[model samples]
Structure formats: structure tokens, C-alpha cells
Target: MVGVPVVLGVRRSAPVPVPGAPDAGAALVDGYGRVHRDLRISLTDRCSLRCTYCMPEQGNEWLARSSILTTDEIVRVAEVAAAAGITTFRLTGGEPLLRADIADVVSRLARITGPGGPVQVAMTTNGIRLPDLLPGLIAAGLARLNISIDTLDRDRFHRLTRRDRLDEVRAGIAAAAASGLRPLKLNAVAMRGINDDELCDLVDYAVTHDAELRFIEQMPLDAGHTWDRDAMVTREEILATLAGRWDLTPVPGRHGAPAERFLLDGGPATVGVIASVTAPFCGDCDRLRLTADGQLRNCLFSTSEYDLLPTLRGTDSRTVDAVLRACVRGKLPGHAINDPSFLQPARGMNAIGG
Candidate 1:
């Protein structure tokens, strides 16, 4: 998704102590008492498919190869984050699997340890390349996978992504499941007049394939800035559509998870909705984003980003830790979608590390 600027708000809750590190317990704790534990690292800003919602079809600017963080730099920053109570490292990208040494990156990150234990590594990908990359990623200690498969129809998929690799994505999904990537998630962007009609079919596909399905509310992250609120398929509409077809019971105890899960009444099938637009979850969010160029974002919608590449290259680990702590201290309470003054962020989703 694209970055959205958050409106500042007064602190409302008592400061929550970090679990293990008492001395530097506040490293990942923001002003509002939200403790960040998950970090999303964007591996690259280049993707094979020019998805209409994520990037412009033509004249898209690609990041310079020299500007992107190297595998060593990524691991160094992740190590500092791990020590500061961040345990989960989710590798994202314009398309992460696009990186030639992505498995090396995963292996290096998997070696990092925090107060909890060894850090858990996961990835979010377009899945067109998963069939070839899945085995290596799993072998390198990747714990989970979130594959974006927006539509089941081949023609519709091509229409949205401008790519005709839906068959490859399907095979990739099967390979991931067969390889035992537990909690494999399929992310779908719910857009009106497009794939909204396939909600049930998508859920059925997930159930049949033994994967979890999640429908994300389309945000104003398109490269062309053509997103309209009226054109979005809201969370309410998604739930109503599913409720009419299946018996769904809310699955509780989802503290920092972005998706609100539901259990399909008749079987082991379950589906989730990431209601980022209609029902914002910023208050319970515990994520920090690292762009491909080494900028750290406290929130997905944060306008401000702290540059970590210089410190990673020049300074010691202590300085990197300090930079991380300072970034967390300044995190906003929420991404101000409800505020009248809200503005779309300058960077699109591909640049922001969705």
C-alpha cells in the first residue's frame, strides 16, 4: 500500500513496558505507548508486473541499483531492530523475488536474534516467481508467505496487473503449500467494478488450496493518484457479501494483526479482511517499514522517514540503535484518514514497501 500522512494526536494510554529489555525497553515504544515488533523490509523497487493500482503502466521511474541497500546493510539494520524488541521481519518489495540474492537475504535475516529468540522471517510477493524461489526461501528459513493473487480469472488478472502470468502464480501457490509454508496468505485488493464480484470465489480458492485468504481495502496508493473513495469496496460491503453466502464467526484475540479473521461455519475454512480504509487499525499496529533505499518508516502512512543507510555504512551498531529508538519515539498515533486535513503521501506503495 501507499504511504498516508498521519495526524498527530495526544497520548491517551499508559506507556506499555517492553517485555525483556528494561534498560532500553522504550527503544521500540512510541510516544503513544504502541510497541512495534514487526518490521517490513522492501528488497527492491522493481517489479515484473505493472499492476494498475500499485504502479503506473508507463514512464515508471526505477530506483538506481547503487541506491538500494545491499544484503549486508539490510541484515545490519535488522540486527539492530531485533535487539530493540523487533522479532518479526517481513521482506516485501515492488516484487521481492525479483532480487537475485533474495534467499541469501532471508538466510542472513533468519540468523538474527532478539530478546524473544531467533527472529522469524516472512515474505510478501507477487507469486509469479514463487515456484522457482519457494524452495530456496523455505530452505533459507522463511517461515511464512503472503502471496498477492488479486483475481482468479486469467483475463481479469492480466487486465489489472498487465501481465499474463496467472498460471505461473497458481503453480507458485501450489509449490508453496506443498513445501509446508504454514500460514500462507493470499492478499487480494478489493476494488469496485473489478474483482469485488470474485470475493466468494477467491475465498473458495483459498479453502480448496489450503491457504488463508485476505481481502485488503484498496487505498490511495496507486501511482497515478486516481483512487476515489466512492470506487472502493468497503469492509462492510465485503462482510455483507460473505455473510449472505457463508456463516462467518469473528475470530478474536488478534492484537497487532492487520487482518480481522473469520471462521467459515461449515468447515476449517477461514478468511480475513484488512479493513485499512473503512476500519483503520493504526492504534493496534506494531509495524515499522524499511524502504529499499534504507529509510525507516514508523507507519505505512508516515510522511517522515529516517535514513539508516548512512549510519549502517559509517557508524557503529549503537548509533543505528539510537536512530531506531528516535524513530519509534516520534511515531504518530494513527494514519489520519478520518481527519479533514489528510493528504496522500508523496511516495506510492511500490516505493514505500507495501
Candidate 2:
């Protein structure tokens, strides 16, 4: 009999299951009964960007180096999450690329299987330093890449990041695309006056390079207290503006990604809009997040979290599995998309794994 090909970083032995381990099917169930398809891991709670919405203020306390999960610890958690039913795992961070050993983490997660049993391992980066890491990351079993390039103007890029690396970021993106990273997603945050003028160019750049571009609504997350509805570039407005230029054909059906995807005519690449602010898709949110410090967040907007690292580290693997199972069972049906009376979270977007 043939055995499954061993992935380099996975445990040679399977996680010890408890006597009453729930059927793997139960692990995949979503609030709407849609199978959970995505899992995002916050590799770190620190970032170099002072992007107004993500880290709005001056001084902040970050996780100590010791508190952050080690690569091995993270791999174990990935195994548990994968065993439970999450098929897609994407590494996020204050900037996941900031972590020195991010490629190691990627190498490990690429070994796991989802409910259907083979998973897609990906990462979201700010692209500030992708040039140094892109090629090695691809070699480490990374299946896809999403690089956040909020603006194209060099001066505007400096204003947004308080630094200058537009040239490096652009180079990194090109290298990643050339390296055959499928669905090379370019993410931009739409702020009312900040960099909105460059939306067309941002989208056009992606098209010219054979990459996919997505514009995400600025949301109320950790750095959300600085949020103002008046400053929003709603999906309707973005679509209306983009539609005037190109005749678009909507990608049919709910493809389950957070963004409402589309393909543009006379364009080299596709564009997608994530309307989390104007038209939130909370009811269909079937993902769970693990912060850099090992806390599992049920909702992206949630301020409360359960510490999975301590529980997983101090307890036996079987007991840890039970705790993980409880975390999933306790998953909220969906985030509060329609609720207006929400308070600004104490944690910032960088802290929340956005």
C-alpha cells in the first residue's frame, strides 16, 4: 500500500484524536451551512506602515518577541485547523513579510490538506520588501500571493507609508508575477481623498502586468476609530466610476471570496471590489483568524479573543484538539454587518490580522 507523500514540515504522526472527536464534516459547517473555505493566520502583530486606518495613532504596545508563536508551534496549530476543515490558509500580519522566518511558516502550512483534502497556502503582503523574499517564498510551497499596493504615485506612496519604496514594491510585484504566482492579487484600500485619483492607474497597472487587482473598503478594525463614513469610496461609486471606462461582465455566482469579483473588457487583468463597508458580507463569513500571538478571533471586528497558544502549549495535543474544536463550535454565525452601534475596537487592523 502507498502512503501519502510526506510534506517536509508536517508531523510524521497524525495529531492524536480524542475519543469523541467530532466528525470531520462538523468541522467544515458554516453558520449558513456553507463549508468553511478560508483560514487567515496573523504571523505577526507588528508592521512598518503607519497606514492611517490600520495603526491610526502614535504610540502602541506590540507583542513581545517571546510571546509570538514559534514556527513549529504555528505548524501544529495549522495541522489542527486543517484537520478540522479549513482548506485555504493565508498568512497575514502587521506585515507577514516582516517576520524573518515567514518562508518557514509557509513551507510548513503548504503540507496540510483541507476538507476536500488538498489545501491552498497563500500570503498577503504590503510589498514593501517583497523583492528580497518573493522567489524563496515561491520555492517554499506558497500557492498564491496578494500584495497590497494602495497607490501608484511615488509622492502619494511616500505620504501613505511615510517612506519611499514604490519602486521596490513595483519591482517585487513584477518578480512575483513572473515567478508564476497564480492569482497574483493586488489589494488597494479606498480612502475618500487619499490616493483615490490613482484607482484607474492601479487597476490598469495590474491589467498590464497580467495580475488581478482588488479594491477593499476601508473598514472599522483596530485602527478604525479614525474611520468616518463620509471618507468612504463605496462599492457603488467605485463600480460606477470604473464602469464608465470599461464595459464589465460580473463574475457569476457567489464564489465565496470576500470580494465581489469582475472581469473588465479591453483590460489586461480582472478587478474585484470588496465592499465590506457599504455592503458587508458578514452573514457568509466562514473564516476564523489566529493572531500572531496565538489568539483565535471569531470575527475580524471582534475585540475579544481566546488564547490558543497557552492552551495548546501547556496541554496535551488531544486536549488541545478539544479546545480547538470548542473554538470552532463557538464560532459566531456571522459578523455584525448591519449593526451600526458598534464601538471602536481596542486592537488595530494590524493587530487583528487584516
Candidate 3:
């Protein structure tokens, strides 16, 4: 409401129980009994940097402006989602900072409340423009942030992202920490023969920056769709690499979180590994995705997407809630990336809202 054109004061409407809809007070539950509370919203598919693992260096087609969701439409869907028990919202994108109205979007959604109370808002970004946007975003109620920093080396950073902006990214990270966003997390995709050897160095860097480093296994979400399972760095290998330098103690229970965390040297500093490829956490997955084009995805690797734009624009709140509920009910048990019949999604990570 702070930066949006629409008027505030819209009341939270009650759920209209259509056939197959969840009971009035039920959260977004799937057949596997996973209650969906986290929603990842992609503000845009256009990015400033073209990471080799995400998209091509050039010639990537973006969504048409008319097809993308407006600020009003996004807030409306968030309201419906809040009513349906979504408690946490994460804004993602090819680069979420690419949108000029990002702070407005954050300010508006931060006001939405679900069963769990004031909804928590987070974001995943490449951090190129975070320094410029951090002040407004923090003032607008951005709860946390996850920045992608695959490699700390200047040349390797350039090779991985097709950009020589590592200094900008590092400055952004420092700025965020100085602003009191503590326990800040930095995401690094572990690619074999790429950044695998720098595991310990990355952790050291995190320690120096007062940030927690998370190493994610590269899944088949690339534009080329040529992901080879054999080439991806695994959780075991990552831990093993770190074991050479520090005594890692697995930091107990994971409550539906994708990352497996560990305390470095059995003390304060920590590191995490998101083994999405080798050790799948689909059973505990409570997240859903909303693309910039207004499509709802039950899973990151889901082959099917439920469109919410038409219902959002042409129908009432009840219909939009019904669509949201239906999408959750239709979630697959897992991504099934290891299955022989698995097929890569038609869109790349940039389009899919990583």
C-alpha cells in the first residue's frame, strides 16, 4: 500500500469451498500432508547478469509486459494466499531488483497476515543492485535475503556469471550485513571442476562477512537443459571438502527447510548444503512458486503450472482462492529428477523464478 496505486483497507475474505476445496480453516495441504505456507514470487524474468548455469549469454526472450502481473494483481493474490494460510513469502526473479517498483511490492505484501500472523517476507537475488535497493527494501519490511555468489574469485566470477561485477556484489553483501540483517545467507551452486575446490575458502569468506554460506547442488534447471547428474557436486563431497579444514557437526533438525546445516569447528560460524539433486527433501517441501507471468507452481521442477492471472483479473476472490487451493492439492510427491521418465522443464531457471 505504501507505493502501490490501489487503495488500502481491503478486508480478508472467507474461503469459498468449491468442490475438492480444502475445508474452511484448512491450510494448503497436499496428498503427502505437506502444508504449503511459503510462496516464492518472481517479480520479473529479465536479469542483469546471465549466469551460464541459469541462462544463455544472450537472446533470451522475456515475458510480454501485458502478460506479467501488475502491482495490484500481485497484492490481490497475496491477500488470497494469506487467507489460505500462506505465512511466508519470498520474492525471487531472474533478478528481482530489475523491477523499479520492487520496494512498493515488498511494502504492500508485508502488510498481509495469515493464520501464523504478520507474514514474513524474504528474497533471493544476484545482489548486483542490492546496495542501491537495500535501504528502501529494509524500510519496506523485507525480512531476509539470499544472495547468489557462486565464486569469490574475480575471473571465476566473470566466467560463471558473464559479468565482471563481483566487487558490486561483495559491496552489496557488506551493506546488507551492516544494516543488521544478520545470519545472512549466501547461495553458491556447487559445480564439479568449477567451484568445488573452493568449499573451505567460501566458508572462510562467510565467516569473514558474518554470513552463512549455503552450497547448492546444481539441478537440471539450466536454459540448455544439458545438466548431467554425474557432473554435479554432491552433499557428501561438499561436506568432505569442508571436513579437510573444519570439524563439522550437523546442526540438528531441519523443519521443512531444503538446506542441511552444520556448525563450523563445532561453534558459531556455520555452513549449509542444499542437496536437491542427490538427497531430495521433497517430502518436507512446503514451498510453492508464483512466476512473474502469474502462474502457480507446486514444485520447482513441476511439469505443469496452474495459471492464476485469468482468475485474478476476470473472477472474484473466491475463484482466485479456489485456484490457489487447487494448485496445492495437485502438487506432486516430489520433483522426480532421478526417475528415468523425468523431463526437464520447458523453461529455464531465469524464466522459472529460481
Q: Model 2, residue 229: what's the lDDT?
A: 70
- Total clashes, candidate 2? 3
Query: Per-residue alpha-carbon lDDT of model 1 for 2-90, expressed as tens digits?
Result: 65345444122323434333245444777666878999999998888888988987898888888899998898889888988999999
TM-score of each: 0.92, 0.88, 0.92
Q: Give per-residue CA lDDT, model 3, range 148-182, as digits (tens).
A: 89898999999988989999999988888788885
Cand. 3 TM to true fold: 0.92
Off by over 4 Å in 2: 1-25, 30-32, 222-224, 266-268, 315-318
Residue 198 lDDT in model 1? 97
The clash count for each model shown is 1, 3, 0
Worst 10 residues of 2 by lDDT: 5-14
Q: Give the per-residue lDDT digits (tens) of candidate 2, residues 14-47.
A: 2222333356435755333444557799989887
Better model by TM-score: candidate 2 vs candidate 3: 3
Show model 3 residue runs off by greater than 4 Å. Answer: 1-21, 315-318
Q: What's the CA error at residue 276 for candidate 1, in Å? A: 0.9
